[model samples]
Target chain A: MLRVVKPRNARSKRALDAREPKEIEDARIAIFVKGTHTGEVVNNVMKDLMALKRPDAISFSKKNVIHPFDESSPTSGSSSIQSLEFWSAKNDASLFAIGQSTKKRPNGLTFVRMYDGKVLDMVEVGIENFVSMNDIKSAKSTPGHKPLMHFASELFDTHPRFIQLKSMLMSFFNGEEVESICLAGIEHVISVSCAPTPVTLNTASTSADTATSLPKVYIRAYTTKLLSSGTRIPRVELVNMGPSIDLVLRRHRDPDSEMLKQAMRRPKLKKTDVEKGLGKKRKNFEVDEMGDLRGRVHVGKQDLDKLQTRKMKGLKGGAFDGETEEERPTKRIKTS
Target chain B: MDVSSILASHNAKYQLVTVEKETPIEVDAGFLTVTDANSIDEDTFNSNIEEHLQSLARDGVQTLLAKLFSLPTLPSSDGPLAQLPPPTTQLPRSKPLPKIKPLTKWEQFAKAKGIQKKRKDKKVWDEEGQEWVNRWGKDGKNKQVEVQWATEIKLHAAEDHDPRKAARDARKARVVKNEKQRFANTAWAQRAVEAREQRKTEIQRTLAQSRLSTASMGNFDKKLEGEKKLRGIKRKFEPTERSVEQEAKASLALLSRMESDSKKMRKNPTSEKSVLNVRKAVRFASKGEGGVALGRKTAGEKSKKGGKK
Candidate 1:
């Protein structure tokens, strides 16, 4: 469940990252089949978020409350990130957002992937279902049926790399547990055969060609205890895959505070227009970390709504800090 | 680096859980750490060091004093038992054993103190019923240990420096005993008696409570799953088995129906109609839900109707 707090100056255009506004107005709430893995739903929601973009400048300050905790919000960071720190929110506070609130508990959807036969399917379990009274939680997951189905469908919509990755995973988990799908378990996998570009394909419901887009990848798991570490290597039939579909795990050094302070240094850009600026890189990211979201410079949710369809800029198949733009708006196909 | 041994180690006690060959199983069990659950389950859990202890005891390892709460009383010492030393060291140094005599009260009391009487103090007066005492170390010979007879006695030191009397004088002074000797003293007997009595009292109390609580236990046991479902019912809390219950209890009374009785209800359609009518026609839905079909069985009606039943 995604909720956008409307800047109280809803009608007026002011710098968002400027000294904290008195009260934020015009909060927009968009419900994604909350945790549904429908690519169309994600694309629509992403487009709505892109429309919310507004390039407002922010001055570097020790007091710049990037995300100050507000007590009035009922969901006040109980289930989401909370801290008075500057980097508490993502790099794009004035830039694009996937709808995060500093004062509200984020309604997150957990996606699980497990193999139903050789096909990788996904299931979703709502955050409400989990037992948590705090913002930070630790979980060791064992994939069951429902969570896997939601995971596969969301992988199809939000991430194209997941296409090949999911297939490779399905073959590995044909009848096994999904938590073991992490790289540590596969002790003997050689390199993936080929690198495929990240392609974002949008499909309307009930289209035959689009339905078979998710093809199965084949793999086998075997163990040689005599050889040591209960390691199982799955032999997967590899294909041309994208530049490590796992970019979420990449790490880089980005002066995010400087970037926001630099944006603040300029006269606030009017709410009507937002210029694309290079986001600072992150310092370090492990290969298995949940991807560097710094360059996730989305055009904010409100402004994206004003832009023309397919013209909303930025998200594409590329690595972070890469200068070139293969700016094809996400590959979207429609059905009658 | 040493792959062969690491690969070879398997928690054999967990034979039920087949270990995949390549998984690294740490065989660190020695004198510490036994985490494999099945090892404790089947009683085969022996650290290599513990196994060595068993073998050491089995091979008649002695001069090694192992403390036992109580040992079997026998005149012979064998194996571990053979390492025990003779009981009396500070008593009379008697080469000749004393002839058994019917002990009078005073003699018995002095003997109970672990003390022996002196040997050489014969009366100078002839055959006039005078008492005699031998001085210490000469086997306490010919000494009758009685305080009443002491008035009729004459005393003297005997051949062996009268060490028994010397030891008695030493004990009379508050001489503290060392660890081994103090532990062998009779004071520990009181502690053993108290521990035994405490356990007996506890057992008696437990048996009485079990007798008194049997009715509550039966009611709880009879209601079993139904009681479990009703717990926290007032709190809007969802029971873990809620999904299974909703699916299985479609039209059955919870009182006698087994949890998976959905099939039986599914086989017949009459129960569904009766449940539906009872739900719609009754004000006492709670009672109707329990399956007594007494027009919702209001409290007044239940009392009157229950009396007859």
Candidate 2:
């Protein structure tokens, strides 16, 4: 549950307004929390991740000894969930990554996403191989620059788990929502590709065993090289920038359908959006690829008598030279 | 031309596929890293530093790749993919820790009184409705008093007394008071910051005044390193070079403005007239002797005797 925050002054009011639900949302802030017994590998992995999520990231230095996924009783994790919810409200953050390691699950990292100060979903992953950025001698992207995400697998679109992971990674790395992107601002690319699924797990039916049998996901970071192509579009190349990691899927909690629907709910279309043809489609009207508003007009049969035409000296008065003005034909000349 | 001789020649020409070292390379499959513990060969290093370093880096990468290829491979469209082991290396944090926020007045009081903050549910159970309803927002329990149809009236109440309006007004006043308290809390929390800024501005004003008080207006004063130059108000003037017609138009506009200002000043003619009557004052000082007599008495009888003679 979120505590109601009443603003005291104009500055505080403006700050609160910024955190309110907006038609166009601001960049989501992510808070990184450390578990009580995080090993060296988990710590390093978290550090590398925090480096990538800089500027819009908050890292909690203190260790929190709470299990978010206690299997005994669902209410057992309520205290931990409450603390996480408290931090979410206090910092106005919606995303969280908890790093914890133990004998059962070594080097485990959990990504917890929140909706309205409540846990929406949690995905736990074990870090397999990690090469930090310091290990590789290459150029790095600017801290705040948004990286272009490239998912090179059909599983990301087809598999349910991969789909959730893809969406989570997208939102995690997503910076400010922009109307347009400058080509030069794209300094790096994050490529995530998974190993082929085992033959036994390829079937449509998914079971608990299939979760462990899921293929490992490889994440690679590369700095983009824009070369002159003698055109407006540049020829791009990818150079390996380190912090490359391989992750094995572990435990996950799927969001409830009703909650998911509420979380995905969007504000109603404004009058301006309706006017811009972005709302309900109107018949016989279309916004073209060039963003021009085009409409098809169906006019009723027009009377030629009332139709005005240009009066030229040659076409005026009469059809023949000897014809009188009153006796002339009243038929209107149709212009092609 | 023998097969053994040909194989030996080919092996000599190509570099060894496996790296040979005094101490075996330590490979951390978890971190995907390899550390070469073998000491540097001074003979090869002294020959060329760049080549030696390149060779070292190459060996490290080669060992790491070999370790990576040894892992369990999963068939993929691109190629066989190996699942990396868990990382073992430790890395330092990239940023400093976040600073703790200053406590508000209410928080300080709560702490002193040892009051534990309790979490309240956003939704409250409605008895009449037999369902949970929002505590405050849209169709909330707070608005139930005003929205309810039935109401109680006191015996001395007026005919036009509206209980709903009174309740709504009281709610609005409470909201206003709450907002005021919130503002007070914010102001109290920022007291130190505001006081520091005020002191800085006061010091700056005093310094500016003292600097201008010098005989040379601090113009010839020795400047300290990194000291900023004080800037005064900038005055803008019309350009000296202009067309004759434009200059004449500007002058005419100025003349009209001055004429209107004078007209406004001359509106009070009576106030402009002096209250002291010069003629009356002169008569009183001279005892009503008239101007000619008064002048002769003051100048003595020299001028009159000279005229009589």
Candidate 3:
């Protein structure tokens, strides 16, 4: 059993921030930005936003995500299409990005094309739809009833200024890079869905144009239930189907300095290969063994020519080896 | 309504059954949670049945008690009775409740503002003066004076590491290294020197030998009779190219000496006693022979001449 509490008075809050209403046919002004931001620019923009919202309503919450990867979507299979139809019954918001192409969806969602600065895009996905839709009776968490959805595991880091943050994209995108938030619309389709919940606007000086024409929506999508042990975890995540800024931050994890200290290592070469690389130039030597030293030794050209007169080295037996005329050796460094 | 067919299929999820040899048994866990269906294992089945029977037994006992007393039996463990403490007895009444004091506007505002004084002194006048002054003075303009005064702490200057001794050591090093460098050039220098001396002496010796030999051959008079060519144009003894090349070797030797001395003195000036001694001698000579502004002892005559040189 769930107890539904009536929303409290937030007139004091709505005066703070109000986005352009999806139901409105026109907007007072639509500001578009070209690129993402650097830290300084984000800081300045956040300061401007804070200044603009100082007088009226705003939302404040602190939460720690323990299991951020737990999420699901409907695009993985057709089994969950019925559940999506049921979802349309309760939630009038336009959440469906693609379809089987019915009168309801001829061209699918043109969400990316319609983005402007004033029209903010954000994504939130969670667990619940996978288990059951409490408002509906026939639906239940079963394998064939509502399937898992797989969204890309890419980064979602934008509007760091708005949230007082710095996304990982800061390394690639300069202050001038185009920025986009994955805008999964949780929108209304008149008879098929209900009005989307508007947040408590931050306290700021808001105009009547905001109150009459805008909606402050928290765009989110959720899974039907947790996966059974029999199910294999997808190579891609089946639960988180939309852009998650927080998840992007979680993926950008860093190791501590202790890890770097652990990495202090030395490079070593194998001693066994040194000799193989050096071959027989390293052969050892012996003393002289030839009959005469002058036969193999070299002198100046003139001296060699006049060797007979110079009497440089006599062809004496074993002269190089210090042997007497008795011993004669072959194959030595010298010649007779 | 004979809905057994429908119920049977729904119960398939929660059911525990022995399959016939001919067929496979597939029961979906979602349709039959362990909570509602018979446990697949004997231990769970016995435990769950035991727990359920115990609650029913307790209910039956309470119902009988209710009939006898004409009042509601103690609610079964299945209800609120399960949450209540053991029937030892109810707690007895004690002291009366105290009143919560409502704070005055002055107290509430002071609490909310979160002001902390240097000490917890309770002076009304002091609070009034300090609180009012601070509240009115919170605009950005008043913070400037405090910020300006706070920013007076200056950074200290960095210590300088003097490399003068290193330079001197490098200079002394050049002298020592020059000796090795000179050794390297010696081989080529010796060869060049030998070649030149041999060529020079051979020219003079060969001419003398040729004249003496001619006399012995009895052709000296004939050979020297009128040969002005030999006297006028004996291949003029221009220094050989090898000698010029040797000059390079010598210069290289000198350069390396200077380089070594410069290197040694640069590496360690004070540690090099020789360089220090030489520097001292040079400074002494410069001081003495460059002429003293003050009167000095005169062992310096030689130094003055060397200084001039």
Candidate 4:
């Protein structure tokens, strides 16, 4: 249960108001938690991740024993979930990363996404390889700068698991939304690609059989360099910025369909969107390929006899008079 | 055979059973993905980019849908649902590995001595009870002396000395010593980290100073490979495009903040006492005799020169 906080003054009231849900939501805040026994690898991973998520990230120095996925006992897991919910409400954070390492599963990191102060889903992965920024010896993107994400696998769009992972990563790295951004503001790119699937696996294998045969995912960060080009758009080059990591997927819990639907619910479109023809379609009017709104008009058949036409001196008497005017060539015979 | 050709033409018209491409699409049904590795047609791409992109997207989606349909599905309330297999791509860890902790004194010594730690069982054998019991808790062997009905004493022990009390005190002392050692270990690690940070700052300061030691302020110095340029503090100011009304409001708010900050600073009891500055008066008076001399004069001790006069 979340403790209710009543603001005592205007300043406190204003601070509370900042955390209230809005039509356009504020950037997500993430809380990095340390487990009861985080080894060196997990600890460093959390630190680096916190660095990337700075300004919107809060880290707990104390170790917490949270069994988020303990299926053996419902009570134990729910207790951990309650603690996470409590933290979420207190800190106004919806995303969390818990780093826990043990003898059985060493160097493990879990990402927990919360919806309405409840755990939505969790994905745990093991750190197979890591290269910190210090080793790269290159310029790093300014802190708080939004990174451009590139997912190079088609599975990200088609597979449920990959789709969830993609969305999680998108929200994790996304900063404040802006209507427009300067080209120079794009400083870095984070590319996530999958290793090619092995040839031995049969294409007709069931989902359960293929679950354990997934390929490794590689995450690479690169600083973008925009150089002058002959055209208006610049030629861009990617320079390797460190913290390159290889991770192996371990365990994941999918959200219920009802809960997922609730989580994905969006606010009503703003007036500006409706004005720009982005809202629901109207009868007989459509936005064409060029984004221009086009409308169809229906009119009754017209009477040609009653239709008004432009008056002309040449056709004053009709076709017979115009022919007589052309046949009167004797006036020009003397000049010839 | 004639009927088969007509059926084939009808099937092609109704359903896009096949997509013709110079390079065949690669499908990974397990992941439900399709990769069209074929190069773009330059003529079509240049002539109409939208049409070309739409065609490419169409092919890709068709291939993906074909692969998705081939997968096994289970009947559900919503319809026949195709389950997605777990993602195979291994992603990079979001963070770097944690730094190793500084070894404690005991650990350092053990490492140097090549001592391997052996695991000890929590339960110990009790000779009298002929059963295994906890070594520490719940009728543990460690508390045997304190819980015993009778205990032996040394021959030279004091008359008032209770063996149980002595044993309990000894156990408590051991716990306190262990706790103190633990504190010392943490303190040592903290000091090591602080010292390292201090050293780093000191080195940076010295380097900064030495760089400015040259006549040209090290601007003309020989550059080293992969050396980073010195960076100065970056200055930021409010946008100049703001309206005058907004600018005035902002300035007023800043002024109020400054006024409040000064008021808070002056809230100290000593500073709030009086307007008269006693330190300034002391400096002004006594012909520059200083505060100590003035205090002596007030205490009825005459100066040497005053006494001579």
- Per-residue lDDT over B242-303 for candidate 4, one digit per residue giving the tens place of the 0 to 100 score: 99899899999988988785757556556456788888888888768899987888766556
DockQ for all models:
0.00, 0.01, 0.01, 0.01
Report the lDDT tens digits of candidate 3 across residue range A204-281: 333322322222111112222222222121111112111111111111112223432332221232333233332234
Top-scoring candidate (lDDT):
2
Clashes of 4: 15
What's the lDDT of the predicted structure labeled candidate 3?
0.27
Residues A24-97 of candidate 4: C-alpha lDDT, one tens digit per residue: 45568899999788987788778877777778899999998886777433535457878888998889898899
Give per-residue lDDT, candidate 4, residue B118.
Answer: 85
Here the TM-score of candidate 2's chain B is: 0.37
Docking category of candidate 3: incorrect
Looking at model 4, residue B276 earns an lDDT score of 84
Cα lDDT tens digits, model 1, B87-176, are 111111101122233454456689899778977444333233454434332433223232223332235755555444554665545345
lDDT of 2 by residue, B108-193 (tens): 99999999999999999999999999998789888988999988989899989999998899999999999998888778768967
lDDT of 1 at A146: 11
Q: Write down the worst ten-residue block by lDDT for model 2 chain A.
A: A175-184
